[model samples]
Target: MISRLSRELSPHLTYHSLYHTRDDVLPAAARLGRASGLNEDEYLALTTAALFHDTGFIDTYEDHEAGSIAIARAALPDFDYSPAQIDRIADLIAATRMPQRPADPLQELLCDADLDLLGRDDFMRLNRALLKEVRHYSHRPVPDDTWMRDQLRFIEEHRFFSPAARTLRAAGESHNRALMRAALASTNGANHAAGGLA
Candidate 1:
Protein backbone atom coordinates (compact mmCIF):
# COMPACT_ATOMS: atom_id res chain seq x y z
CA MET A 1 0.00 0.00 0.00
CA ILE A 2 2.80 2.40 0.91
CA SER A 3 4.66 1.56 -2.29
CA ARG A 4 1.49 2.00 -4.32
CA LEU A 5 0.75 5.37 -2.79
CA SER A 6 4.32 6.57 -3.28
CA ARG A 7 4.30 5.37 -6.88
CA GLU A 8 1.02 7.10 -7.61
CA LEU A 9 2.29 10.38 -6.23
CA SER A 10 5.79 10.15 -7.69
CA PRO A 11 5.21 11.57 -11.15
CA HIS A 12 2.85 14.24 -9.89
CA LEU A 13 5.17 15.19 -7.03
CA THR A 14 8.18 16.36 -9.01
CA TYR A 15 7.02 19.83 -9.99
CA HIS A 16 6.29 21.01 -6.48
CA SER A 17 8.52 23.55 -4.74
CA LEU A 18 9.67 21.43 -1.80
CA TYR A 19 10.07 18.35 -3.91
CA HIS A 20 13.77 18.24 -3.17
CA THR A 21 13.44 17.58 0.54
CA ARG A 22 11.23 14.54 0.08
CA ASP A 23 13.87 12.20 1.48
CA ASP A 24 13.80 13.84 4.89
CA VAL A 25 10.30 12.37 5.24
CA LEU A 26 11.21 8.69 5.67
CA PRO A 27 13.61 9.24 8.53
CA ALA A 28 10.84 10.97 10.36
CA ALA A 29 8.60 8.00 9.63
CA ALA A 30 11.21 5.54 10.87
CA ARG A 31 11.70 7.62 13.98
CA LEU A 32 7.99 7.65 14.59
CA GLY A 33 7.79 3.90 14.36
CA ARG A 34 10.78 3.40 16.63
CA ALA A 35 9.68 5.95 19.18
CA SER A 36 6.02 5.06 19.30
CA GLY A 37 4.47 1.65 19.88
CA LEU A 38 3.21 1.38 16.32
CA ASN A 39 3.05 -2.15 14.88
CA GLU A 40 3.37 -3.16 11.24
CA ASP A 41 -0.14 -1.99 10.31
CA GLU A 42 0.24 1.18 12.32
CA TYR A 43 3.65 1.72 10.77
CA LEU A 44 2.13 1.34 7.31
CA ALA A 45 -0.54 3.79 8.35
CA LEU A 46 2.15 6.20 9.54
CA THR A 47 4.04 5.86 6.29
CA THR A 48 0.90 6.55 4.34
CA ALA A 49 0.16 9.30 6.81
CA ALA A 50 3.55 10.90 6.26
CA LEU A 51 3.44 10.64 2.48
CA PHE A 52 0.08 12.30 2.03
CA HIS A 53 0.19 14.69 4.96
CA ASP A 54 1.37 17.63 2.93
CA THR A 55 -0.33 16.69 -0.35
CA GLY A 56 -2.79 19.52 0.01
CA PHE A 57 -0.17 21.65 -1.69
CA ILE A 58 -1.27 20.01 -4.93
CA ASP A 59 -4.70 21.53 -4.66
CA THR A 60 -4.90 24.85 -2.74
CA TYR A 61 -2.95 25.85 0.34
CA GLU A 62 -5.95 26.62 2.49
CA ASP A 63 -7.32 23.63 4.44
CA HIS A 64 -4.90 21.28 2.70
CA GLU A 65 -5.49 18.90 5.56
CA ALA A 66 -8.95 18.33 4.23
CA GLY A 67 -7.48 17.92 0.78
CA SER A 68 -4.97 15.40 2.11
CA ILE A 69 -7.72 13.51 3.85
CA ALA A 70 -9.61 13.41 0.59
CA ILE A 71 -6.59 12.08 -1.25
CA ALA A 72 -5.81 9.46 1.41
CA ARG A 73 -9.43 8.30 1.54
CA ALA A 74 -9.63 7.99 -2.23
CA ALA A 75 -6.34 6.14 -2.54
CA LEU A 76 -6.89 3.75 0.34
CA PRO A 77 -10.52 2.81 -0.23
CA ASP A 78 -9.51 -0.80 -0.83
CA PHE A 79 -7.61 -0.95 2.45
CA ASP A 80 -10.99 -0.73 4.17
CA TYR A 81 -9.61 1.05 7.19
CA SER A 82 -11.97 1.04 10.11
CA PRO A 83 -13.86 4.17 11.03
CA ALA A 84 -11.46 4.58 13.97
CA GLN A 85 -8.41 4.44 11.69
CA ILE A 86 -9.91 6.92 9.26
CA ASP A 87 -10.80 9.27 12.08
CA ARG A 88 -7.33 8.86 13.57
CA ILE A 89 -5.72 9.94 10.31
CA ALA A 90 -8.08 12.86 9.93
CA ASP A 91 -7.52 13.99 13.51
CA LEU A 92 -3.78 13.52 13.11
CA ILE A 93 -3.80 15.78 10.09
CA ALA A 94 -5.89 18.32 11.91
CA ALA A 95 -3.46 18.25 14.82
CA THR A 96 -1.01 19.97 12.49
CA ARG A 97 -2.99 23.12 13.07
CA MET A 98 -1.00 26.07 14.27
CA PRO A 99 -1.08 26.84 17.99
CA GLN A 100 -2.82 23.59 18.82
CA ARG A 101 -1.60 20.74 21.05
CA PRO A 102 -1.36 17.19 19.74
CA ALA A 103 -3.71 14.77 21.51
CA ASP A 104 -1.78 11.49 21.23
CA PRO A 105 1.46 9.79 20.28
CA LEU A 106 0.59 9.48 16.61
CA GLN A 107 -0.59 13.03 16.43
CA GLU A 108 2.53 14.14 18.29
CA LEU A 109 4.80 12.32 15.86
CA LEU A 110 3.00 13.92 12.94
CA CYS A 111 3.18 17.36 14.45
CA ASP A 112 6.83 17.03 15.38
CA ALA A 113 7.78 15.59 12.03
CA ASP A 114 5.89 18.30 10.18
CA LEU A 115 7.91 20.96 11.97
CA ASP A 116 11.02 18.86 12.45
CA LEU A 117 13.28 21.54 11.12
CA LEU A 118 12.55 23.92 13.94
CA GLY A 119 15.69 22.76 15.72
CA ARG A 120 17.94 22.55 12.72
CA ASP A 121 20.91 24.87 12.35
CA ASP A 122 19.41 26.35 9.20
CA PHE A 123 16.06 27.09 10.76
CA MET A 124 16.15 30.82 10.12
CA ARG A 125 16.88 30.43 6.45
CA LEU A 126 14.35 27.62 6.14
CA ASN A 127 11.72 29.68 7.92
CA ARG A 128 12.36 32.67 5.68
CA ALA A 129 12.00 30.42 2.67
CA LEU A 130 8.71 29.09 4.02
CA LEU A 131 7.57 32.66 4.50
CA LYS A 132 8.47 33.26 0.89
CA GLU A 133 6.58 30.12 -0.17
CA VAL A 134 3.49 31.28 1.68
CA ARG A 135 3.67 34.76 0.22
CA HIS A 136 4.10 33.33 -3.24
CA TYR A 137 1.62 30.44 -3.10
CA SER A 138 -1.05 32.05 -0.95
CA HIS A 139 -0.65 35.44 -2.62
CA ARG A 140 -0.76 37.01 0.78
CA PRO A 141 1.73 39.55 1.99
CA VAL A 142 3.13 38.61 5.38
CA PRO A 143 5.19 41.14 7.23
CA ASP A 144 8.03 40.14 9.52
CA ASP A 145 6.21 41.24 12.63
CA THR A 146 3.11 39.28 11.83
CA TRP A 147 5.16 36.19 11.09
CA MET A 148 7.06 36.57 14.33
CA ARG A 149 3.86 37.00 16.28
CA ASP A 150 2.35 33.87 14.78
CA GLN A 151 5.48 31.93 15.67
CA LEU A 152 5.58 33.40 19.13
CA ARG A 153 2.04 32.30 19.80
CA PHE A 154 2.82 28.84 18.55
CA ILE A 155 5.97 28.51 20.61
CA GLU A 156 4.25 29.80 23.69
CA GLU A 157 1.20 27.58 23.39
CA HIS A 158 2.71 24.31 22.16
CA ARG A 159 5.07 21.54 23.23
CA PHE A 160 6.27 18.17 21.96
CA PHE A 161 3.58 15.51 22.46
CA SER A 162 5.31 12.16 22.77
CA PRO A 163 8.08 11.32 25.24
CA ALA A 164 10.27 10.36 22.31
CA ALA A 165 9.56 13.62 20.52
CA ARG A 166 10.15 15.57 23.68
CA THR A 167 13.30 13.67 24.64
CA LEU A 168 14.80 13.59 21.19
CA ARG A 169 13.70 17.02 20.02
CA ALA A 170 13.25 19.08 23.15
CA ALA A 171 16.18 21.27 22.22
CA GLY A 172 14.10 22.56 19.35
CA GLU A 173 11.78 24.35 21.71
CA SER A 174 14.62 26.30 23.27
CA HIS A 175 16.11 27.09 19.90
CA ASN A 176 12.75 28.32 18.70
CA ARG A 177 12.33 30.34 21.87
CA ALA A 178 15.67 32.03 21.39
CA LEU A 179 14.91 32.81 17.79
CA MET A 180 11.49 34.19 18.67
CA ARG A 181 12.94 36.39 21.37
CA ALA A 182 15.59 37.73 19.05
CA ALA A 183 13.00 38.47 16.40
CA LEU A 184 10.78 40.27 18.89
CA ALA A 185 13.68 42.35 20.10
CA SER A 186 14.71 43.16 16.57
CA THR A 187 11.19 44.23 15.71
CA ASN A 188 11.08 46.53 18.71
CA GLY A 189 14.45 48.00 17.81
CA ALA A 190 13.31 48.62 14.25
CA ASN A 191 10.18 50.37 15.49
CA HIS A 192 12.30 52.61 17.73
CA ALA A 193 14.69 53.34 14.90
CA ALA A 194 11.80 54.23 12.62
CA GLY A 195 10.36 56.50 15.32
CA GLY A 196 13.63 58.41 15.43
CA LEU A 197 13.71 58.55 11.62
CA ALA A 198 10.17 59.88 11.61
Candidate 2:
Protein backbone atom coordinates (compact mmCIF):
# COMPACT_ATOMS: atom_id res chain seq x y z
CA MET A 1 0.00 0.00 0.00
CA ILE A 2 2.80 2.39 0.87
CA SER A 3 4.65 1.42 -2.28
CA ARG A 4 1.61 2.01 -4.47
CA LEU A 5 1.03 5.45 -3.00
CA SER A 6 4.70 6.36 -3.27
CA ARG A 7 4.81 5.28 -6.91
CA GLU A 8 1.70 7.17 -7.90
CA LEU A 9 2.56 10.28 -5.92
CA SER A 10 6.29 10.55 -6.63
CA PRO A 11 5.94 11.26 -10.32
CA HIS A 12 4.04 14.52 -9.94
CA LEU A 13 5.85 15.96 -6.93
CA THR A 14 9.13 17.82 -7.09
CA TYR A 15 12.06 16.04 -5.50
CA HIS A 16 13.27 18.79 -3.17
CA SER A 17 10.33 18.78 -0.72
CA LEU A 18 10.05 15.00 -0.77
CA TYR A 19 13.76 14.41 -0.36
CA HIS A 20 14.13 16.27 2.93
CA THR A 21 10.77 15.33 4.39
CA ARG A 22 10.95 11.61 3.61
CA ASP A 23 14.12 11.20 5.65
CA ASP A 24 12.55 12.89 8.65
CA VAL A 25 8.90 11.79 8.53
CA LEU A 26 9.12 8.13 9.51
CA PRO A 27 11.76 8.77 12.15
CA ALA A 28 9.65 11.53 13.62
CA ALA A 29 6.59 9.29 13.60
CA ALA A 30 8.60 6.57 15.25
CA ARG A 31 9.55 8.98 17.99
CA LEU A 32 5.94 9.99 18.33
CA GLY A 33 5.16 6.30 18.88
CA ARG A 34 6.86 6.61 22.24
CA ALA A 35 4.17 9.01 23.36
CA SER A 36 1.56 7.58 25.76
CA GLY A 37 -1.85 8.53 24.43
CA LEU A 38 -1.69 7.11 20.89
CA ASN A 39 -2.83 3.50 20.48
CA GLU A 40 -1.71 1.10 17.71
CA ASP A 41 -4.45 2.06 15.27
CA GLU A 42 -3.89 5.72 15.99
CA TYR A 43 -0.17 5.14 15.42
CA LEU A 44 -0.90 3.67 12.01
CA ALA A 45 -3.14 6.55 11.19
CA LEU A 46 -0.43 9.01 12.17
CA THR A 47 2.16 7.17 10.09
CA THR A 48 -0.15 7.04 7.12
CA ALA A 49 -0.98 10.69 7.55
CA ALA A 50 2.70 11.61 7.76
CA LEU A 51 3.51 9.69 4.60
CA PHE A 52 0.77 11.24 2.50
CA HIS A 53 0.81 14.64 4.16
CA ASP A 54 2.88 16.18 1.44
CA THR A 55 1.50 14.14 -1.45
CA GLY A 56 -0.71 17.02 -2.45
CA PHE A 57 2.41 18.92 -3.46
CA ILE A 58 2.53 16.48 -6.37
CA ASP A 59 -0.49 17.79 -8.25
CA THR A 60 -0.16 21.46 -7.22
CA TYR A 61 1.85 23.61 -4.85
CA GLU A 62 -0.90 25.87 -3.68
CA ASP A 63 -3.32 24.20 -1.21
CA HIS A 64 -1.60 20.84 -1.60
CA GLU A 65 -3.10 19.83 1.72
CA ALA A 66 -6.47 19.53 -0.01
CA GLY A 67 -4.73 17.83 -2.91
CA SER A 68 -3.21 15.34 -0.46
CA ILE A 69 -6.60 14.70 1.08
CA ALA A 70 -8.00 13.98 -2.37
CA ILE A 71 -5.07 11.70 -3.18
CA ALA A 72 -5.50 9.70 0.02
CA ARG A 73 -9.23 9.31 -0.52
CA ALA A 74 -8.66 8.09 -4.06
CA ALA A 75 -5.74 5.77 -3.33
CA LEU A 76 -6.90 4.20 -0.07
CA PRO A 77 -9.79 2.28 -1.64
CA ASP A 78 -7.43 -0.36 -3.01
CA PHE A 79 -5.76 -0.79 0.38
CA ASP A 80 -9.10 -1.51 2.06
CA TYR A 81 -8.38 0.82 4.92
CA SER A 82 -11.25 0.94 7.42
CA PRO A 83 -13.54 3.92 7.03
CA ALA A 84 -12.47 5.24 10.42
CA GLN A 85 -8.81 4.91 9.49
CA ILE A 86 -9.50 6.73 6.25
CA ASP A 87 -11.13 9.59 8.10
CA ARG A 88 -8.26 9.73 10.57
CA ILE A 89 -5.69 9.86 7.81
CA ALA A 90 -7.64 12.54 5.96
CA ASP A 91 -7.89 14.62 9.12
CA LEU A 92 -4.20 14.21 9.84
CA ILE A 93 -3.26 15.35 6.32
CA ALA A 94 -5.58 18.30 6.50
CA ALA A 95 -4.11 19.30 9.84
CA THR A 96 -1.01 20.49 7.99
CA ARG A 97 -2.82 23.36 6.35
CA MET A 98 -1.48 26.87 6.90
CA PRO A 99 -3.01 28.68 9.83
CA GLN A 100 -2.94 25.23 11.37
CA ARG A 101 -3.50 25.25 15.10
CA PRO A 102 -3.86 21.57 15.95
CA ALA A 103 -6.25 20.72 18.78
CA ASP A 104 -4.89 17.28 19.64
CA PRO A 105 -1.51 15.62 20.05
CA LEU A 106 -1.84 13.35 16.98
CA GLN A 107 -2.62 16.27 14.74
CA GLU A 108 0.28 18.14 16.30
CA LEU A 109 2.70 15.31 15.47
CA LEU A 110 1.74 15.24 11.80
CA CYS A 111 1.87 19.02 11.58
CA ASP A 112 5.33 19.09 13.08
CA ALA A 113 6.55 16.46 10.63
CA ASP A 114 5.09 18.36 7.68
CA LEU A 115 6.78 21.62 8.68
CA ASP A 116 9.76 19.84 10.14
CA LEU A 117 12.20 21.72 7.98
CA LEU A 118 11.48 24.95 9.75
CA GLY A 119 13.56 23.44 12.51
CA ARG A 120 16.06 21.61 10.28
CA ASP A 121 19.84 22.03 10.49
CA ASP A 122 20.37 23.10 6.88
CA PHE A 123 17.54 25.60 6.93
CA MET A 124 19.23 28.39 5.00
CA ARG A 125 20.38 26.09 2.22
CA LEU A 126 17.00 24.36 2.18
CA ASN A 127 15.24 27.69 2.08
CA ARG A 128 17.23 28.60 -1.03
CA ALA A 129 16.35 25.28 -2.60
CA LEU A 130 12.65 25.78 -1.87
CA LEU A 131 12.79 29.21 -3.43
CA LYS A 132 14.48 27.63 -6.44
CA GLU A 133 11.74 25.03 -6.67
CA VAL A 134 9.14 27.78 -6.75
CA ARG A 135 11.16 29.65 -9.34
CA HIS A 136 11.43 26.57 -11.53
CA TYR A 137 7.75 25.73 -11.41
CA SER A 138 6.23 29.20 -11.29
CA HIS A 139 8.80 31.01 -13.47
CA ARG A 140 9.01 33.70 -10.83
CA PRO A 141 12.55 34.66 -10.01
CA VAL A 142 12.80 35.48 -6.33
CA PRO A 143 15.76 37.71 -5.63
CA ASP A 144 17.96 36.57 -2.79
CA ASP A 145 16.98 39.45 -0.53
CA THR A 146 13.32 39.06 -1.38
CA TRP A 147 13.50 35.34 -0.72
CA MET A 148 15.33 35.96 2.55
CA ARG A 149 12.73 38.45 3.72
CA ASP A 150 9.96 36.05 2.87
CA GLN A 151 11.68 33.25 4.72
CA LEU A 152 12.24 35.49 7.72
CA ARG A 153 8.59 36.40 7.77
CA PHE A 154 7.63 32.76 7.55
CA ILE A 155 10.02 31.74 10.32
CA GLU A 156 8.62 34.46 12.51
CA GLU A 157 5.07 33.34 11.81
CA HIS A 158 5.53 29.57 12.14
CA ARG A 159 6.83 27.08 14.72
CA PHE A 160 7.05 23.33 15.30
CA PHE A 161 4.40 21.72 17.47
CA SER A 162 6.54 18.92 18.88
CA PRO A 163 9.05 19.50 21.64
CA ALA A 164 11.70 17.39 19.91
CA ALA A 165 11.46 19.40 16.74
CA ARG A 166 11.48 22.67 18.64
CA THR A 167 14.50 21.78 20.75
CA LEU A 168 16.52 20.19 17.95
CA ARG A 169 15.55 22.48 15.06
CA ALA A 170 15.71 25.87 16.75
CA ALA A 171 19.21 26.62 15.49
CA GLY A 172 18.07 26.47 11.91
CA GLU A 173 15.36 28.96 12.70
CA SER A 174 17.80 31.42 14.23
CA HIS A 175 20.34 30.89 11.44
CA ASN A 176 17.73 31.60 8.80
CA ARG A 177 16.90 34.90 10.46
CA ALA A 178 20.52 35.99 10.42
CA LEU A 179 20.83 34.93 6.78
CA MET A 180 17.75 36.97 5.90
CA ARG A 181 19.06 40.15 7.48
CA ALA A 182 22.36 39.76 5.67
CA ALA A 183 20.65 39.27 2.35
CA LEU A 184 18.55 42.38 2.84
CA ALA A 185 21.66 44.37 3.67
CA SER A 186 23.52 43.01 0.66
CA THR A 187 20.71 43.89 -1.71
CA ASN A 188 20.55 47.44 -0.38
CA GLY A 189 24.32 47.84 -0.63
CA ALA A 190 24.25 46.76 -4.26
CA ASN A 191 21.48 49.22 -5.03
CA HIS A 192 23.36 52.03 -3.29
CA ALA A 193 26.52 51.25 -5.25
CA ALA A 194 24.65 51.29 -8.54
CA GLY A 195 23.14 54.69 -7.76
CA GLY A 196 26.45 56.17 -6.61
CA LEU A 197 28.25 54.94 -9.74
CA ALA A 198 25.54 56.42 -11.96
Candidate 3:
Protein backbone atom coordinates (compact mmCIF):
# COMPACT_ATOMS: atom_id res chain seq x y z
CA MET A 1 0.00 0.00 0.00
CA ILE A 2 2.75 2.43 0.95
CA SER A 3 4.66 1.43 -2.18
CA ARG A 4 1.57 2.43 -4.10
CA LEU A 5 1.46 5.73 -2.25
CA SER A 6 5.14 6.41 -3.03
CA ARG A 7 4.53 5.90 -6.73
CA GLU A 8 1.34 7.94 -6.77
CA LEU A 9 1.95 10.74 -4.26
CA SER A 10 2.53 14.16 -5.77
CA PRO A 11 5.93 15.81 -5.94
CA HIS A 12 4.09 18.83 -4.59
CA LEU A 13 3.32 16.89 -1.39
CA THR A 14 6.69 17.18 0.30
CA TYR A 15 5.36 17.48 3.82
CA HIS A 16 2.81 14.73 3.35
CA SER A 17 5.03 12.34 1.42
CA LEU A 18 5.89 8.71 2.04
CA TYR A 19 8.82 9.51 4.31
CA HIS A 20 6.75 11.70 6.64
CA THR A 21 4.14 8.96 6.82
CA ARG A 22 6.48 5.99 7.09
CA ASP A 23 9.07 7.56 9.35
CA ASP A 24 7.42 10.23 11.47
CA VAL A 25 3.64 9.98 11.62
CA LEU A 26 3.37 6.20 11.78
CA PRO A 27 6.00 5.84 14.48
CA ALA A 28 4.51 8.63 16.54
CA ALA A 29 1.06 7.12 16.41
CA ALA A 30 2.37 3.80 17.64
CA ARG A 31 4.26 5.47 20.43
CA LEU A 32 1.20 7.47 21.41
CA GLY A 33 -0.93 4.35 21.31
CA ARG A 34 1.36 2.68 23.80
CA ALA A 35 1.66 5.74 25.97
CA SER A 36 -2.06 6.31 26.03
CA GLY A 37 -2.62 2.66 27.03
CA LEU A 38 -4.89 1.95 24.14
CA ASN A 39 -6.28 -1.58 24.03
CA GLU A 40 -5.45 -3.85 21.11
CA ASP A 41 -8.51 -2.86 19.14
CA GLU A 42 -7.92 0.85 19.72
CA TYR A 43 -4.24 0.56 18.87
CA LEU A 44 -5.04 -1.22 15.64
CA ALA A 45 -7.64 1.38 14.83
CA LEU A 46 -5.23 4.24 15.50
CA THR A 47 -2.47 2.68 13.41
CA THR A 48 -4.79 2.06 10.50
CA ALA A 49 -6.16 5.58 10.71
CA ALA A 50 -2.62 6.98 10.82
CA LEU A 51 -1.72 5.02 7.72
CA PHE A 52 -4.58 6.47 5.70
CA HIS A 53 -4.77 9.93 7.26
CA ASP A 54 -3.01 12.06 4.68
CA THR A 55 -3.77 9.86 1.69
CA GLY A 56 -6.23 12.40 0.43
CA PHE A 57 -3.12 14.29 -0.65
CA ILE A 58 -2.65 11.38 -3.01
CA ASP A 59 -5.64 12.83 -4.87
CA THR A 60 -5.73 16.56 -3.95
CA TYR A 61 -3.92 18.88 -1.60
CA GLU A 62 -6.82 20.99 -0.43
CA ASP A 63 -9.29 19.57 2.13
CA HIS A 64 -7.77 16.21 1.47
CA GLU A 65 -9.04 14.81 4.77
CA ALA A 66 -12.43 14.07 3.28
CA GLY A 67 -10.78 12.23 0.44
CA SER A 68 -8.66 10.35 2.94
CA ILE A 69 -11.78 9.17 4.69
CA ALA A 70 -13.17 8.04 1.38
CA ILE A 71 -10.02 6.09 0.62
CA ALA A 72 -10.11 4.53 4.09
CA ARG A 73 -13.69 3.35 3.62
CA ALA A 74 -12.84 1.80 0.29
CA ALA A 75 -9.66 0.05 1.45
CA LEU A 76 -10.11 -0.86 5.11
CA PRO A 77 -12.59 -3.67 4.60
CA ASP A 78 -10.01 -5.62 2.64
CA PHE A 79 -7.95 -5.83 5.81
CA ASP A 80 -10.87 -7.60 7.58
CA TYR A 81 -11.77 -4.50 9.53
CA SER A 82 -15.46 -4.31 10.41
CA PRO A 83 -17.66 -1.47 9.26
CA ALA A 84 -17.70 -0.15 12.84
CA GLN A 85 -13.91 -0.30 12.99
CA ILE A 86 -13.63 1.44 9.62
CA ASP A 87 -15.95 4.14 10.84
CA ARG A 88 -13.86 4.62 13.98
CA ILE A 89 -10.66 4.81 11.92
CA ALA A 90 -12.31 7.28 9.56
CA ASP A 91 -13.37 9.41 12.51
CA LEU A 92 -9.83 9.47 13.86
CA ILE A 93 -8.43 10.57 10.49
CA ALA A 94 -11.06 13.25 10.10
CA ALA A 95 -10.28 14.66 13.53
CA THR A 96 -6.76 15.37 12.36
CA ARG A 97 -8.07 18.16 10.17
CA MET A 98 -7.38 21.79 11.01
CA PRO A 99 -9.22 23.20 14.05
CA GLN A 100 -8.73 19.62 15.36
CA ARG A 101 -11.87 19.04 17.33
CA PRO A 102 -11.28 15.57 18.79
CA ALA A 103 -14.34 14.08 20.46
CA ASP A 104 -12.74 11.15 22.26
CA PRO A 105 -9.48 9.79 23.63
CA LEU A 106 -8.51 7.95 20.47
CA GLN A 107 -9.16 11.01 18.35
CA GLU A 108 -7.25 13.17 20.82
CA LEU A 109 -4.24 10.89 20.69
CA LEU A 110 -4.29 10.80 16.92
CA CYS A 111 -4.57 14.57 16.71
CA ASP A 112 -1.68 15.05 19.12
CA ALA A 113 0.51 12.63 17.21
CA ASP A 114 -0.21 14.37 13.91
CA LEU A 115 1.07 17.70 15.25
CA ASP A 116 3.77 16.30 17.53
CA LEU A 117 6.27 18.46 15.67
CA LEU A 118 4.84 21.37 17.62
CA GLY A 119 6.59 19.95 20.71
CA ARG A 120 9.79 18.56 19.31
CA ASP A 121 13.33 19.99 19.35
CA ASP A 122 13.60 19.68 15.57
CA PHE A 123 10.53 21.86 15.09
CA MET A 124 12.23 24.70 13.27
CA ARG A 125 13.98 22.32 10.94
CA LEU A 126 10.76 20.44 10.21
CA ASN A 127 8.97 23.77 9.85
CA ARG A 128 11.35 24.84 7.10
CA ALA A 129 10.57 21.62 5.26
CA LEU A 130 6.88 22.39 5.63
CA LEU A 131 7.39 25.92 4.32
CA LYS A 132 9.23 24.60 1.30
CA GLU A 133 6.31 22.24 0.73
CA VAL A 134 3.83 25.08 1.11
CA ARG A 135 5.75 27.10 -1.46
CA HIS A 136 5.74 24.17 -3.85
CA TYR A 137 2.01 23.55 -3.60
CA SER A 138 0.93 27.19 -3.40
CA HIS A 139 3.23 28.34 -6.23
CA ARG A 140 4.34 31.36 -4.20
CA PRO A 141 6.76 32.05 -1.42
CA VAL A 142 5.26 33.15 1.84
CA PRO A 143 7.25 36.00 3.33
CA ASP A 144 9.48 35.06 6.27
CA ASP A 145 7.78 37.43 8.70
CA THR A 146 4.37 36.19 7.66
CA TRP A 147 5.47 32.60 8.05
CA MET A 148 6.94 33.24 11.48
CA ARG A 149 3.87 35.17 12.60
CA ASP A 150 1.58 32.41 11.39
CA GLN A 151 3.71 29.81 13.13
CA LEU A 152 3.64 31.79 16.33
CA ARG A 153 -0.11 31.96 16.18
CA PHE A 154 -0.45 28.23 15.53
CA ILE A 155 1.97 27.19 18.27
CA GLU A 156 0.33 29.55 20.69
CA GLU A 157 -3.09 28.23 19.85
CA HIS A 158 -2.13 24.55 19.77
CA ARG A 159 -2.46 22.40 22.87
CA PHE A 160 -1.67 18.72 23.18
CA PHE A 161 -4.81 16.89 24.24
CA SER A 162 -3.12 13.62 25.10
CA PRO A 163 -1.52 13.43 28.52
CA ALA A 164 1.31 11.33 27.15
CA ALA A 165 2.23 13.88 24.50
CA ARG A 166 2.11 16.77 26.94
CA THR A 167 4.18 14.94 29.52
CA LEU A 168 6.77 13.93 26.99
CA ARG A 169 7.15 17.17 25.04
CA ALA A 170 5.55 20.14 26.76
CA ALA A 171 8.90 21.63 27.76
CA GLY A 172 10.21 21.26 24.24
CA GLU A 173 7.07 22.98 23.01
CA SER A 174 7.71 25.82 25.43
CA HIS A 175 11.22 26.17 24.07
CA ASN A 176 9.75 26.24 20.57
CA ARG A 177 7.39 29.01 21.56
CA ALA A 178 10.32 31.13 22.77
CA LEU A 179 12.32 30.42 19.63
CA MET A 180 9.39 31.40 17.42
CA ARG A 181 8.93 34.65 19.35
CA ALA A 182 12.59 35.56 18.87
CA ALA A 183 12.52 34.61 15.21
CA LEU A 184 9.37 36.63 14.66
CA ALA A 185 10.87 39.67 16.43
CA SER A 186 14.02 39.49 14.32
CA THR A 187 12.05 39.13 11.12
CA ASN A 188 9.84 42.07 12.02
CA GLY A 189 12.89 44.22 12.70
CA ALA A 190 14.44 43.30 9.37
CA ASN A 191 11.17 43.93 7.54
CA HIS A 192 10.85 47.32 9.19
CA ALA A 193 14.38 48.26 8.12
CA ALA A 194 13.68 47.11 4.58
CA GLY A 195 10.45 49.10 4.44
CA GLY A 196 12.22 52.26 5.68
CA LEU A 197 14.89 51.92 2.96
CA ALA A 198 12.19 51.43 0.32
Q: Model 2, 24-64: lDDT tens per residue?
A: 67667656555535688888888888878877766777888
Q: What TM-score should be assigned to candidate 2?
A: 0.80
Screening candidate 3 with a backbone cut-off below 3 angstroms (N, C-alpha, C), the clashing residue pairs are none
Residue 183's lDDT within candidate 2 is 72
Candidate 1 residue 125 C-alpha distance from true site, Å? 1.8
- Score every model by TM-score: 0.77, 0.80, 0.95
The most accurate candidate by lDDT is 3
Over 106-126, each residue of candidate 1 has an lDDT whose tens digit, in order, gives: 777877777666655656666
| lDDT at residue 195 of model 3 (Cα atoms) | 96
The candidates, ranked best first by lDDT, are 3, 2, 1
Model 2: how far residue 70 lies from native, Å: 1.8
Clashing pairs in 2: none
Global Cα RMSD, each model: 4.3, 3.0, 1.3
C-alpha positional error of residue 124 in candidate 3 after TM-score superposition, expressed in Å:
0.7
Runs of candidate 3 with Cα error greater than 4 angstroms are none
Q: How many residue pairs clash in each candidate?
A: 0, 0, 0
Estimate the lDDT of model 1.
Answer: 0.68
